[model samples]
Target: MSDAFSPPPSPGGEVSADQRQMALFSHLSSLSGLIIPLGNILGPLILWLVKKDTMPFVEDQAKEALNFNITLGIIGIVLTIITVVTFGIGAVLTVPLGILLGIAWLVLTIMAGLKANEGQYYRYPFALRLIK
Candidate 1:
C-alpha cells in the first residue's frame, strides 16, 4: 500500500520551500471547521482546486486531507443519529465516541501539516480512500 500513497514524482530531487508551505496549508486548512461547519472539507477542496495542477505534493496531500475530513464528518453524523434514534441511551457511548473522533481528527491533521511542512508525504491511516 506504500505504492498507493507514494508522492507523485518531482522533476527536481527536492521539493522547494514554497511547495512545502502550500502543502502544509492544505492540511492545516482543516482547522477552519471550528469557524464553519464542513469548513474543513471546503478549505482543502478550494486549495487543492487552485493549486493541484501546479503542485503535485499539494494535490496528493490536499486530497488525503479532504477524504479524511469527509469520512470523519460522515461517521460523526452516523453516531449522532444513533444517539437520537436510541432516545439518548446511545449517548452514553456515542457522545464519547464522537469526542474521540474529533480529537483524533485534530491531532492527526496537525501531524500531517508538520510532515508536509518538512517536505515529506503523510498518509492518514484508517481514512477511507474515497477520493482518488
Candidate 2:
C-alpha cells in the first residue's frame, strides 16, 4: 500500500451507480421551484455558482435548468417590453408566444428533471452547454 493517504475520487467515480443517481436527483430537487417561470431559474442559477465542480452530472443538469429558466424569463420580459413599446400590438402577439414558450419550457424542464431522477444524463435541445 502507498505510504501517503489519497482522497477518493468524486462520487461519480468512487460511489456505486445508485448513489450517483441519487446525487443527481437531489440536485434536481433543489431545482423543483424553477418550473414556475422566474422561480424556475433562480434556484438553479444560484446553485450552479456553488456546485459545478463538485459533481459533473449535477452541474450539467443544473446548468441546463438554469439556462432553460433564464431563456423563458428573458422571452417573457422581452415580450412584455415589446407589448409596451408597440402600444399593444406586441401584447397581442405575446399571448401566443407565451403559450408556446410556456409549453416548451414545461416539457423540457420536466423531461430534464425526470431523466435526472431516473439516473440518466439529460441534455436539453438548444441548450448552451457550459461544461464539457
Candidate 3:
C-alpha cells in the first residue's frame, strides 16, 4: 500500500539474455523425459533452438540433455520389444537396465544444469549428435 513496500524493478531494467538462457537450461534439466518426450519437441527444442547463438553453452547443454533422453527412450523401447519377443525374460533385464539408464541420465542432467548455471558447456556420454 506504500511506495516503500513496492518490489524493486529488475536490476538491469530488462531481463538479460544470460538470465533467460539459464532459466531455459534449468527447466530442460528438470523436465528431461517427462516434458521433453520424443523428438525434443517442446522444452528441449525451444532451448536448443532459441538459446543457441545467444547462449551457446546453455543451448548445447540443453541439446545434450535432449539427445540423452531421446536415446534413453529408444533404448527402453528396444528393450521392451526384446522382452516381449523373448517371453518376459528380457523384461527383467530391461527393467534394471532402464533404471540404471534413468539414474545415469538424471545425474548427467543435474551436472549439466550446474555447469550451465556456472556458464559452462556439459557434454553427455552416449548422447547422439542430434542438434548441430
Best by TM-score: 1
Q: Order of candidates by lDDT, top first?
A: 1, 3, 2
State the lDDT of candidate 1 residue by residue for 64-123, as single tens digits: 899989889889889989999999999999988988898999999999999999998888
TM-score for each prediction? 0.91, 0.67, 0.70
List clash counts for every candidate, in order.
0, 1, 0
lDDT of 3 by residue, 1-132 (tens): 524222223333444457555744644545545654453335666666777676545555566666666666678789889999999988778889888877886677766666556544456657666655
How do the residues 1-132 of candidate 2 rate in per-residue lDDT, one tens digit apiece?
Answer: 522122223445443454346435534543456545445656676666666766565666676667656656667889989988999987678989888887787677667667676656555665544433
Query: Clashing pairs in model 2?
Result: 34-40
TM-score of 1: 0.91
Displacement of residue 41 (Cα, Å) in model 1 is 0.5
> Candidate 3 — worst ten consecutive residues by lDDT sum?
2-11
Q: Residue 119's C-alpha lDDT in candidate 1? A: 90
- The best-first sequence of candidates by TM-score reads 1, 3, 2
